[model samples]
Target: MKLACIENIRRQKQHVERYKRQLARHRSGEDISLKSQKTFRKPKQEKHLKSFQVYKDVLFDEFLDKSKKLQKLTNQILKVLSQVWESPK
Candidate 1:
C-alpha cells in the first residue's frame, strides 16, 4: 500500500510537471500550429489563460494534499509495524 501510494505520488508529480511544461510552452507561443497556405492564428485570450492557471493551481493543491495524507498514513503504519515487531512473540 505504501509503495502504491508512493508510485501514485510520483505519477501525479510527473503529470503536474508535464502540465506545467505544456502551459509554459503555450504561454510562450510555442504551441501554435502553422497552416500550409491559409494561416489562421487564434488570438490568446486572457480569460482562458487565467482559467487554465487557476485549474493548474487547483490540481497542484490537490496533489499536495494527497501526498501529505499519504506521508502521514505511511508514518503511522511504520510506527505500528515497528511496535508490533519489537513485541515478544
Candidate 2:
C-alpha cells in the first residue's frame, strides 16, 4: 500500500514537471528541449521490432500480468484515480 502511494507521487511529479516545461516553451516560442521536434511515432507494428525501440522498458512484465493477483489491486488503483484523476495520497 505504502509503496503504491510512493509510485503515484513519483508519477505525479513527473507529470507536473513536463507540464511546467511545456508551458515555459510556449511562453518563449521555442521547442521544449533538444529532440523535441521529432514527430510522433506510432507504436510498433511488429513486436520483435519494438524491442529495439524506447518503450522496450514499458514491455509488460509478469508483475503486471492480467491474470495475476495484482490485477485486482491494479483495478482498485484505477478506481481511486478515476474518481478524481489524481494520484491517491
lDDT value for model 1: 0.82
Q: What lDDT score is found at residue 44 in candidate 1? A: 73
lDDT of 2 by residue, 1-89 (tens): 99999999999999999889888987998855655546556556765576657566665775477557677888988898798766566
RMSD of every candidate to native, in Å, equals 22.5, 23.9
Q: List pairs with backbone clashes in candidate 1.
A: none
Please report, in order, the local distance difference test score of every candidate based on alpha carbons.
0.82, 0.76
Which regions in candidate 2 have their CA more than 4 angstroms from the true location? 32-89
Give the per-residue lDDT digits (tens) of candidate 1, residues 1-89.
99999999999999999778767877997854333224644557977898898887677778999999999999999999999999999
Among all windows of 10 consecutive residues in model 2, the one with the lowest summed lDDT is 34-43
Clashes of each: 0, 0
**Candidate 1 lDDT for residue 76:** 100
